[model samples]
Target chain A: MGRAIRQAPGRAPRTTRSLAHARFLLALTLAVVGLVLIVMLAVTIGPANVSLAQVSGSILGHLGLGATGTDSGAVPLLIDSIVWELRLPRVLTAAIVGAGLAVSGAVMQSVTRNPLADPYLLGLSSGASLGAVCVVILGVGFALPAAAFLGALAALFATLSIARVGGTITPARAVLAGLAIAQLAGAGTSFIIFWSAKGDSYREILNWLLGSVAGATWNSVIISGTALALVGTGVVLAATRLDAFAFGDTAAASLGINVNATRWALLGSVALLTGAMVAVSGAIGFVGLILPHLVRGLSGPSHRRLLPLVAVCGALFLVVADTLARTIFDPRELPVGIITAFIGVPVFIVLIKRKKSSAWS
Target chain B: MVVAVPGSTAGVVIENLSFSIDEQVILAGVSASVAAGTVTGLLGPNGAGKSTLLRLVGGLATPASGSVTLGGDEIGAMPRREAARRIALLEQNTAPSVDLSVEDVVLLGRIPHRTRLLGTFGGDDDRAVAAESLAAVGAGELVDRMWHTLSGGQQQRVQIARALAQRPSLLLLDEPTNHLDVSAQLSLLSQVGGLGTTAIMALHDLNLAAAFCDHILLLQDGKLVAAGTPAEVLVPEIIGEVYGVECDIIEHPRDGHPVIVFSAPRTAVAPMRAAASA
Candidate 1:
């Protein structure tokens, strides 16, 4: 009946616009490959002079894949221990933490409809730090990861309650509430450290606060890896629904999405993911904030494309950053968070300056 | 084919709907019915609850009391995805902070048709519908353009295209012509009028309502003050009583529809003469 409005001269014909999909697939493939290569390269670059071949041989031999004709006797046991025991766990833990934090950040940005939102914006990191520090100083019987997750959930509830006024959560109010909780949690963390921490334990708490993977073990790898698979996959699968939120709550609700429920679920998922990562990594900063922004430049704003790509890129970025943090100072080590910020700030500024136009105003 | 009549089971019926937030009522006991295959105008001044009524019908908000039925089915009882497949709402002043291409923005309308885990069960069909909707709204050429780059009218047109992509039977719009120029407004309304779907649009321009709407519902202070054909409801008394302004209604020579000409308020409150009585 409305055919009259369809008249236009020389209109472009609709072609199969599969190019974007092809590009996305290509990016995903590249990211997967890049992560593998970066992990391989990062494990080789540690203070122990493990060559690429020996590292591969050790990994293959451990996997029960026979080493490719390399002399097993030539590869020393200590180097194998350094590669397999020390560096590999740390690198894998960094990668998982990166992926989880990046996914959490992307989901947070989409749910809040705020471009600047990151995993830590809801006071997750500070709360987790508080939990971790309490366990460290007070010699609590509870596991640090469990305590940290609970603390993050507590902070989330507090932030949500404060932000929600008259049944609406404005972004400004949420950010403000998060800041308040973060500061409160940070003060508590500092107070616990000041009052109860003794000697080397204070150093331990300091390293945790600054976010180091120096003490990462196979346990950390298993914990962060499981969290990433369970919660991160859920967030990625929920990407389509997240796209509905681009316009705002009303439009999303009209599209048949239960906006409030979806928002709460997504928020809770992010909190869980971030809490798990923080429990393992002690609140590594900048990866959550910058990786999503950087990946968005390549994948555009579609979470379907952005989530997996950001996960991989974040993994690569953190693996590289952690490798540098441990090896750059030779005998001494720095917190990985310091390295991420040092590298991330410049890269972020460059990205901001390089873009002629932004998706957001 | 049996020609479906307007105001049939496919139409929308809102009965005694009331909504309040924080002890402030937004819509009160508003009852109205719109017929299928006709354009209905929701005419009201600012804060008159036109948007709220539309929201209730779109199933975005629940009425505190009473019910909304679409096609003889209670809307609140319908599954959200099922209801979305039938109805689309175009809201006012929605400037998304995200950067999305026009095509992607329109593709959002296909969400209701998509699976929960994986979106757009039929990708090719969804893309075609989005393209056709963009063309339907005269935004076909802007398909590749980023949303932030579009002008206000173009953005509005793209928003309409997004809504159209849903392939809805009942479309609700809030001030759909707020950003359009005069010519664009006329053409947009003409396009909507010819769509053959039941459309309930909240409008501020009384002349446009008179020209395009088959039925008019006038609201004042959350109450339905008048409802009928435009000729019956656009009378001066109802207009003045609701809008608090004096207005003259003239018949358009071309279409024989009522065109309102507004004037200053008939009663001007005089300043208190220096509290003379005190």
Candidate 2:
């Protein structure tokens, strides 16, 4: 019906169009290739010190291609176990969790219309920690990931209820309410840690709190992989709607969006995605906060171009960071969160100084 | 000018439209009709509910106890996407929270027309339409510029280009010339006149309304005070009654349209002020 309006005469020359999108696509393609390379390389960098050949041989052999393994003389059992059992699942978990957190962060920033927003800023991580603490320190019977998801959902409900008091939820009110819930959840987690945690068990609890994928198994990979595949795709497909919210609520409504429904759906999707990532990786920080902004610098703020690249960049970033976390201290490993923060703060500072005036409205 | 969509262009009819917020009435049973393919100016002082009335007509809000119909279809009953395809509203002083390119902002107008199930980005035809819309508004060269870097007048033009890209049969504008210079304002209003679609804009400038709009609807205290041609409705008495200001109307030298020159407030309040002092 509206095709005539689209067929206006003398179509504008294609060469006159902006090359920013072309540049963005090139960058996205490079990022995907870089991620694949890094994933293979990250698998080989450890105390075991395996080569790329061994890593590939182990992987292909496990996927039912036994010919490659026979060429390497049946691929030693120890190397195969390391590549398939320990390193592969941990690296995959890092990549999946990274993608999930980064997507959640991008969606959160757009939905809240705030540049500083991240998945963890809304109490999801603290709530998940509280859930994990209940099971670990207090001897609760629930599965750790399930408990964490429920706790994250509960925190989201609380934050929304507080924001909704006396009126509809504005972005400012929702952010403020999230801060309140984060603080409340943080205090509860601390109290439980101090009152009940005993001796060396405190170290384990601290490791989970600080965030790590060191304990990731095939089960962890399955949990986070499924979440990212489902919720992550849904969010990315709906990312275009996030652009409608760029101007304001009324403007989006005038653009034919059901503003309230779109906002709730996105926020809910982000919560589910963020909760799954946290359940698997124990609230890995900085990947969610820094990756989207870093990618946005390359892709501008159009969510369609910005999000897919952000997901890939995030996967590359965490895979590299987790590799450093395990190998940096030799036998004593550090949580991946520490490396991310160390990297994130400097990059974040540079971003703030460079784009301070132009990044925000 | 863009080709008008067949069968979608229709006049707006607001009948007994009333709306309130927290028990405070914003629009009180105001009724008005805008003929198809004609430019109408909505004029009133602050709190006169001109913007609210535009919102109702655009189907962004539903009336409390009455109806707004576009062509023969009730605006409130149409799907949001269908309503957006038929009506576009250019709001005043709205900017995106994130930095966006001028072309990206213009492409936003294509969202309602997206027919694919999971269309995450605009296609070739959409981009062509967006570029054409920008060219129509004299902003084709600004397609790559960042929105935040534009001057107020330039930004206003980009916003108009975005609205044009929507290809709506009916256009609603709230102070579309709000922050522009005199020449910019004149050129923008002229562009609006050239667009060939039905349009209703709320304007504070009487002379601009007289020069561009084919019809005038004067509002006062949530009610429509007058609805007619500028010569019929831009008389000094109606203007003074609605705006509480004294004004004179003269014929424009070139076009013979009403030229309203606003003067001081009316003298009705002098005796009341003297009695309060006593």
Candidate 3:
């Protein structure tokens, strides 16, 4: 065993027993600092020429601190309003949405004990899309995302129901059910979009298909961000149980996880986060699918390590993806969803080619 | 690490425990008492119901017509976590997950005792016993390694350590040494028997079972054909009647235990096959 440890490579020359512990601590410390920097950069980069001070001041004020609306109490409120009221919300929402999606993906992957199990593949985003579309186009229902939220919850429960038989959920059954239900919901959505028959409605729905932060507002951002923090932290704090989940059901059961209860808790939280994010930003893909996997490669697959790692990486990944989406096409901005897949795919392909880490055994 | 809670009786007892699956009677009508502080070997052949009986005992599978009592109480009535803490079962070929670390896998054994939702692995929760559990089967160094990277024999030992970490009063292991080498096989049985914890294991190796078991329960097609001390149950006549093989049951010189000397079955006139023309 000592020989194997020595052979693992990429360690300090001394290679004491404490080295792996030291490396983990270092990875955690660096990840935390890097996350803070990404948050600032994400908030700062935009088409609007808001100074860094203005960005910090608005953030501080939003946090209910003593920060003034104006940077030096000299500039007029006009520029501050543009920075605070307009671009800031979108950037913050991107981080919140990213964190929620990644954590959801991580938790989902653990619960199913299938590496391929992520929130997107389970039809959650598509379900949210169906709900949002129903409310927006039908004009007969509720708030913009509330309808979508319900849809995500419905899809989550439906999938669990389909997979479960006699109190046990097998990996084969779960993937099969998810594939069937996701396809079914997606077909229903396409039918609704085509049947709507109005050109303006088509464009609006199309814009949504390419998830945007164009409708970002402080109210929606606060709601989504708060939900993300509350639920995401809750999931992280429950990290140990999530780690047990990676051991599969009977082992987990003997380990005393009420397998059914744990499954429901993870699924409920994931569905809620997915619904809220999809409500705010339409159907952003790849961040949930790809970011968690990337983070796992850097840090191994311990959820205690994986969740926080993925949360930061997912936030940074989406924020950067959104920025590229806005900048790469200039005035004719591409949808953030387009940017995520466009950027996410090549990295994903490379990761696959390297065979350094497989999401599955 | 095995603790006896006040009023917590930790032995397993079966009374008329019959079970059927897919309309097939597996354990027809079985009754046995695996007393506290002894290792009971459930000895059987391929089609026997030893595994089924152990599953019912572990609370993994419900019996069709009877109950398995644990700690002198019906297992169905024991609180879920309470039951888990008192009894740990290890089955064969646990589909290894590549991503989990060995420590992460072992911490799972402590879950039944953890009341907090997060199940923090504090110093006490590390199962200071985990080290001993690992060392008993010689898997202590595998603690930090990724679980999937371990060799098959090493993996099996780690699993026993996990069950040991559970601090179970009654440990049930099913065919635990299937992939293990000879030394590992003897070493693991000695550890379990040495623990003085009540262990009822379904072991395929009759010789190993005879060497370690304080009591042997021979099952033929799910019925308890015979039971008692190893010497009493592992007789040459009983072995021939149950296994339908010619064998010699002799005293093991070193341990003064009964050992089997297997012999080829006597040839009988073949029941004629259908004629090729037909």
Candidate 4:
């Protein structure tokens, strides 16, 4: 089901085929290894003099797999707290957020048949931010995260409804509607935050708006992990329909796809993943937009190859970016969104300059 | 469960087939029949229901209170994919999507042959069949070329190859030669005509239709005004009545086929001027 179409010109070299397949597998494997190493380094490299061994043992012990700690007091407790309650979930949360966002982006791009279309481009993030803003600034919901999740979900629904006005959703129409609603949501959020400014509480708005995994804990990890598993399976199940649709709606229909059902099912799945991602990570932008394109470039735009490859690369991409955010300033941590945008902007510029955007269609 | 459709059958019959978009009445209750394994040509002016009737028979649209049937079964009664498996439709001016190679587009014709639960292309369904389809229309090398990068004629041939790949019992084409040059157009229609599959093609040029088609269907303002061999349907009186033009049609010397020659419209009102002179 996951086979990449073997296509090459002239007398296709056997070595070239094996090499390309080998390269894809190697890249994914190395990325996983690199992510694991970075997660360990990230756990131990802060102000505390925690060694690699200490972090590993703490993790192993927490998992009921390592040697017990020698120190019986606050030292062992602090180690357990940092490794278990803090760094572990933060790293896991970044990976999960990356996977969910990337998968949804790939799905959305294929469904919309527009390369620039990302899951959050439909106002999922801004909606979530609006939800968080009303709670954080106006004291709307004392539980800010839950409020942000609901707000994000609402925004996704609103954008989808506006785009689907005539019982048909075109690529240009959907994007236009999404942009309009996103601006409105942004304005509403700014109005609430600006009018109700009290002291330096603007910093709270910054954290949520800019996106941070600073809030990640074991609980968020569990919930986000479950959501990704359920939704990822759904995406893979719809893989053939996506492949058929890559040809366009008419072709897909001739192939016997119920265009309406497939569209709604895909819309619901991507919206859920986008909402869940924003709810957990407060909208770490750019990875969703750029990662799928990069993967598609490497492996041609077949969804069978594109979806899983995009997921792994997305997970690896976010974990590395978040690690840099934590380690770049060392003592003072920057938000992961800042790092993602900083990386995303130049790559996006290069993508724009590349004259084959028409090729994406 | 590969359940068969209730009314799936083996031959097509079009009765009073007509279609109009935005009230323009492209096809006016045109009726025709294409027997199994025979290649037929649909010939008419630019806006004729040639394509419209083809679409009707292909089940792309339902007729305006008319019936299109396969064997004894109405086309509207069969399930869509099962119906698609029976008839392959190649519409004109279809653009190839980005990054999809020619092989990918050709392989799409095998979609109906797929088992939905396990949607994998099997070993028996690989390069051999694709190569055979490509070879049928002399596109054996283009099986690897990117679809978006092909020339207009090459792309048309590739699409024909795709329809051939479907191995559909009934192949329906709508002006499959719109932008093609002379040789490409001839070889395409000629090859398809000899492919041993039942083919119904809408063609603009009466000469090519006359040369290659077993039977010709002539349409005018959506009416099935004429249907016969191309030589019979392409007479001067019928062509003039349908197109409002004076023309001389002569049989070709080498191949001995009927050829149509269009004369320019008269700027002078000859009938009124003759009356004034008198």
Candidate 5:
């Protein structure tokens, strides 16, 4: 190593790095502000006619802040029930699930060194679906969230064991194993649906499979929020070590990282976060897969720069998508996954068409 | 500026090193010592464990048995980060999954220097070192470019800059000139030779090795066949026996460096056209 003492950056490259940093900060700030506005807008636009002031008042009243209303009185009980009881938890769940899935996707891609990887790449979604199907169709008595979370964990363990069959788990082997398990679980889910799904239960299973935040309560908010706060933060904090992986495992090892240990830790964290999101939202698509790629063009590929913005963009994206899901069809709600896929496929095509993007190169 | 000093406390010593995979022996009972602040060329044909030896020496892989000591301290005993702070390896094959900017790639070299748990982002000093390393490798102008946008030769230079940014005392490179044009190959070697750090590079070209290396270790089937100065090791007798080719040694016109000129294999078969048709 050169001098152990640090030196100030030279004039030229300092400006360049800081400029990128400033851009990242600006994007993050904009995304956060957008998320807050969208959440408020989403809270007000539900089937129940609620104004933005009423929504804010309800939230403030519940937060123990003095409820300042247009009529100089407390917000109406009906408005409070609609906003706080009905819409707020749903929006919050969507946002938390979005952020968690996006961060998980970013970490997954980096750890596996695959551009196409997502949080559910390890068969978490298929496993969760199989669990939820059993609960809804077969009338299994386990709580829906518990069953789904356990199913996801089981899938993770199975995939990892298969990958570890002959030797240490490699990214290629894990991915392949995950694919195999996904297929098996997917077939199992299909078989259950085909064999036993009744009339009303079909709609229920379909809704869960397609993912919805319509049933989100404060409990959903708490579950997804705590997971994001814990695992998402750790993944973001490991950004530099993630960057060490850009040149492959040997290069990362030479840079002093324990390649296998770091990979396992990161993969485990991503699985936990993804499992939490899946348990709540039932495999909401596109936010995890598309959000990181969408923001990578703006934030660049460094996880330190890309992850925060991806989380924010993801939250904003899902909140908007969920709002559109409920309101666009008005009274009849589409699953949020349908909206995400509808939006995600087009955006993904556009991103792919922009072949000059160095992020993909 | 401080003169380039040996980053480790002393030279590296290897004793009876052995490595294998899947019950297949790769290297067996190989031993050598490398003096500090010198460039040594590790010369061998394909499958001779040259890459494996570099990985072992750089502490990227553990030897099945035996020890490699750097500056008298065993490498395997050191924490990964401590070993990384003293050594850097440039592997022959590596490609980023994402399209990273050249600066982002080079800044990764500063990871080991960070002490804080949350020090994930690079500070000003890292950018400076990255820039300095780029300039050192003559890739300063390429910093803003994306890694995938660079030509093969440019990419090689940037990769070298990333390694230089680590400012390692012991630099190990596997075939540093693999896919470069002649000019690029020359420039890259010259740049590496001027770094003043102790370096061990695997090379295929005898002439380049002879010109740039201070010492040479020749291997055959993962065993050291010869170890000496380039003049001592690159003689026709040893080259013919190991490489199975007829070759003549001639001194360079300008520098008097030994250059090997190959004529043909000792027992040449029919040409490729007839052989392939058969």
Candidate 6:
């Protein structure tokens, strides 16, 4: 019986398991390298046409590694200002926001057990937007991110309360509750905008609404970057617990996870991450909604291999998308949201039409 | 059969357990004990609270008024993780929405055994255990197949593999054979019978229960109607009263287990008046 068990018919050979593990590792390493390359290449592609070498030299020089060329003294002040002061922060912010949103989306989908669930599925983006618009329009002295984070927490509480029926939350109820909250928050934002806007403030609010990294500063980079690193690390560490949920709530509970508590904590953390990204970049779309599915197509549904890769790919995607958004329109400068929608909608359709069997039913 | 050694912790003992949802009592004061290493069939009709009773014993739900003890330890007082290490429950019709390979699904059984959050949960040892479990369920060859692609019987087999991977001392299954064919159902119960673990299985098939279960606990309307060896519990009178149908009980020629055969309802109505007029 032992020998028969060992030689069971459909079990993949030991070699295959190792090979799959190796494949995941290879994919992860490639994504990391790709992210680094994209970030490097993106910083060099803005309107001023800063050469790759100068971009590299300026980055190295800032790190106290000394400039690459002998004529370091002759480096133009304008190029330095453009590279260090303008483009680098914006690109970095875009990358971080992308990563944050994608990770949030992946976590949300797993928690809700819904394929269509995105980071904003719980009305997070709308809540954050409401907070931001209140700040921008009402001239509130509070920082926009603080207000946005609070708004997101409020919306999460409201959604949870609405979804909860006799102490259990079904996926359908949660989705419907989130949709209702999203619409309510959206209407609130629109009302605030309509009631208050006067002069150039309208342009500022519009820029925020459309989701642009055009105004990204060092502070924006710091805020989004820190949020991604902190919250992203937590999400990756919790991957195993999340994997236990693959079978459903009762199965996860049987596996020793406190299913309800884990779901609530994870949902809260995702909201925090999404709120931070939304506060910084003004509700960029698609990166969160589509990137996880794309990554799952390459790596299987194990969150252990899925989470980190999703984060990196998300960063790579946003950096590339933002680059296109700014460069494609030249001086006019389109918002990154518009660019993501154009690319996202077609890819989503193709994914649907391909009808390949995915982990998501 | 492994008999319960009086004071051993290997058996499950339930005392005066009651549970209700929204004023609808699902199980009321139900009590029974399953011996160590015996396959005890939970026989009941639909809405008879068999599933609810199994959940309470598995600690998936808390009883309203009584207690379940496993080996003398209060199951409700045990830490969920500790309880999980010793007990595994397989619910009916479980199909994960997420796409996962058969191996991955089986590996989920190892979660309670995993000690650290940061380390790899499914290591070589875990994979070996999972493979052994799949092999035990005759599903070893399906380790690479996607879960959604599998037929219902295949999925049930894989789910059994997942439960086996837990290596639980007490296994609870709720209508595990619902999607399986006759042979598959018999084979699965036979496999469980050989595992040397105390198993409580909720089953609708009286014959299958008679053939495989060492003992039978018959339930009706949230209460225990009968509990004993198959011959003692599966009488025609109890079957008639509980199922509202007439039935005959006979000894199986091969195994001497009680075999139940149902007859048509005794109170058949006369020919309809409308049909007579037409």
Q: Which model scores highest in lDDT?
A: 6
Candidate 4 lDDT score at position A223: 67
Q: Is candidate 3 or candidate 5 better by TM-score?
A: 5
lDDT computed for candidate 4: 0.72
Name the regions of candidate 5 deviating beyond 4 angstroms.
A1-11, A68-72, A131-150, A153-180, A190-199, A346-361, B1-10, B96-98, B269-278
Q: Over the stretch B1-278, how does candidate 6's per-residue lDDT look in tens digits?
A: 32111111279999999999999999989989999889999998899999999989999888899999998999999988888888889998666334888899999988888874755767898888888788777677888888878887778878877887877888899998997888778777787786677889999999999999999999999999999998888887788788887677878998899898776565665453233222
DockQ of each: 0.44, 0.39, 0.29, 0.22, 0.40, 0.43
lDDT of 5 at A9: 35
Query: Lowest summed-lDDT stretch of 10 residues in model 6 chain A?
Result: A352-361
* Residue pairs with clashing backbones, model 1: B7-B35
- Evaluation by DockQ, superior candidate among 4 and 5: 5
**Cα deviation of A147, candidate 3, in Å:** 3.4
* Top DockQ model: 1
List where candidate 6 sits over 4 angstroms from the true fold: A1-6, A9-12, A68-74, A139-142, A160-177, A346-361, B1-9, B270-278
lDDT of 3: 0.73
Show the colliding residue pairs in model 3: B9-B71
Native-to-model Cα distance after best TM-score fit, residue B106 in candidate 1, in Å: 0.9
lDDT of 2 by residue, B155-193 (tens): 887887788777888999999999889988987887777
- The candidates score, on chain A by TM-score, as follows 0.88, 0.86, 0.82, 0.83, 0.84, 0.88
Q: Give the per-residue lDDT of model 1 (tens digit) for B100-162.
A: 888888999999888889675327788778877777766777887889788777788788778
Q: Which order, best to worst by TM-score?
A: 6, 1, 5, 2, 3, 4
Query: What is the CAPRI rating of model 2's predicted complex?
Result: acceptable
* Model 2 chain A: ten consecutive residues of lowest lDDT: A1-10
Worst 10 residues of 5 chain B by lDDT: B1-10
TM-score of chain B of each: 0.89, 0.91, 0.88, 0.87, 0.91, 0.91
Candidate 4 residues A1-361, lDDT tens each? 0001222235552344356557777766776687678778777766566777777878877666765556442237677677777887988899889888889888887876766667556777778778777775677644655665677668767877887755666555666776787778777776777788677556555555567887898877876787788888888877767877666666565665666688778867776676667767776777878898888766565566677778878888888888888888877788898998898878756754663444232
lDDT of 3 at A122: 71
Docking class of 4: incorrect
Which portions of model 4 miss their true places by more than 4 Å? A1-20, A49-52, A68-75, A131-177, A192-201, A207-209, A355-361, B1-10, B16-30, B43-55, B62-64, B71-73, B121-124, B219-223, B266-278
